[model samples]
Target: MSIQEKRNSDFFLRPRFSIDLKENPEELLERITTYLKSDACIYRSNVADKHVFIDIPVRKSHFWSPQLHFEIVKVDKNSSTLKGLFGPKPQVWTLFMFVHFVVATLFLGVGVFAYVQYRLGESLVFPIAILVALPLIWLLLYFLGSIGKETGKNQMKELHNLLITIIEQ
Candidate 1:
């Protein structure tokens, strides 16, 4: 199987891969199920109602890890296209987005308030300090997200291997 993967630095951007397989969708799905069940690591796997979701923790009990999704679309009677996406868990992604939003809103609100106070000749030191700190916090969060991605890098590779092995077979 030939797989092409795309990646980006943004935390929200997930790595996606596309591959064409000689087998039909059902056969591909069967191979994936077999692989997941035979793997030693316990994965939260679900396949029903034409939906597939797999959660393989990078480490057992770890708070964060990437999720893998697969969809098989039949292109012909003997060929199918497999699409794969790898990203962090939904809750973790949502929480990160919420935190970033809060930081940005606070920064803007305080910035405007600080500007008004400055126009009225009030102290700028504390407001400026806070305004400066918010961006720094945001940057720190970006770095932290990068760290989280790095921490899960190995698991990402494992998931990729699992997918490729099943598809190639």
Candidate 2:
């Protein structure tokens, strides 16, 4: 299946609208908002495939910034497919938490091993091992994080391009 199809299958409530705009950004936004207000939940507006995903929570608060909560995937002249991808914030947070948990587990295990080594009257192998492993663990985590970000960006870009194609037709 296509990426768009995959996304559609995943979303419980995906309301997508495509518009060809002659008006300015402000007017286009106003028009899109009017159409979106009816749903009052999850809606996507794609103007020539430059997509803006909006999420309206149950409790409305003007103090909160929608941009922070919602993902706005845009496509410009210099934009790559990488720019269009957006990973869900919750999933990203969860991934980071899992990484931290794994790192903590490794540290705890190493500490216990070191304690046992000390009880057996060994040299400073535990400390040396930890010093070497810590940096390696950090490097792995950094690489994973970068990979996730790049994947999300690429997905968003592909989605934007697909949306644009759909809108054009």
Candidate 3:
């Protein structure tokens, strides 16, 4: 199995990859459905329209494992474009996005307050400390996300391997 080029940013928790297959969209989807049935780790496979969604429950971990989604679009009579995305459950992903938004909004507010205080020649110590703390919290969140990514790395590989195995067959 050769390494597949992942199309995700370093800071992103969701990873995606795409490739062209020399099969019609229907044939590709059929092959995928057949493979998912035989895969022990995967449960709850759903295919709708041209997309496939699979649930991968990890062992001994309370957190939800990342889901795998595939979209197959026919390019011609004998070719199709396959795009895949691997991501955490919606609740987990939304929580992370909410945290980021809150941190950024609070940081901006604190920075504005600090600037205003400085212009008035007032004490800048407390506001400056808050300004620093917000970003530290943001950085901490980033590192935590990175750690989460690392924790899920192996599972991600498993999902990718399944895709490759099915496609190659």
Candidate 4:
């Protein structure tokens, strides 16, 4: 079935809230968690400098079609309002950057090595090696990066959930 059709067939409800960031992150999180636990809301966020866009689910179902999604609900518009809520956690970003750097270094090093080997009287072997390996290396890197991003997204979601739980009590 088409995405829209699938969505229409499934249960879909958007959570109701009037979010304002003037309150502290902890307070806001507490309120959100209270709402979530009471109503079993699922949520996602698109964080930005001046605003955070949140999507809260109001349906009661194990599964929802991808097309059955809610638009972003703006929470905050002032950067200062989100100081504690928006900035990257140092450890997470550090690890991510480290992994990215390592992957890039490995790719460049292998590419250069293959090129040098070809130049050192390996005949056309090195060129063929490079042709085969470079694309594969790049593709692998791309996939790995994508996986990392997905992982990060999952982690963020979990963290948000955890924060909600902590604030609820």
**Across residues 1-169, which tens digit of lDDT does each residue of candidate 2 receive?**
1222223332311123223333344443444445555564243433333344543232431221121122233243322121222344445556667887887788877887788778888886756689579768877876765655454444444444544543233
* Candidate 1: residue 120 Cα off by (Å): 2.1
Query: What TM-score fits each model?
Result: 0.77, 0.38, 0.82, 0.32
Ranking by TM-score: 3, 1, 2, 4
Error of 2 at 105 (Å): 3.0
lDDT of each prediction vs. the true structure? Answer: 0.76, 0.45, 0.78, 0.41
Model 1 C-alpha lDDT per residue in residues 1-169, reported as the tens digit of each score: 5555444444454666667677777877887787767756377777764456778753552555787887777889888777777777889889889999999999999999999999999999988999999999999988887787777777778777766666676
Residue 96 of model 1, lDDT score: 86
Q: Which residue window of length 10 is worst by lDDT in model 3?
A: 1-10
| Better structure of 1 and 2 per lDDT | 1
lDDT of 1: 0.76
Of the pair 1 and 4, which is ahead by lDDT?
Answer: 1
Model 2 scores a C-alpha lDDT of: 0.45
Q: By the TM-score metric, which is better: model 1 or model 2?
A: 1
Q: Quote the positional error of residue 115 for candidate 1 in Å.
A: 2.5
Kindly list the per-residue Cα lDDT of model 3 for residues 1-169, writing each as its tens digit: 2333447675676777887777888887888887777755355678888998876654533364677888988899888888889887677889989999998999899899999999999999999999889889988987887787788777777777777877888
Runs of candidate 3 with Cα error greater than 4 angstroms are 1-12, 37-41, 58-61
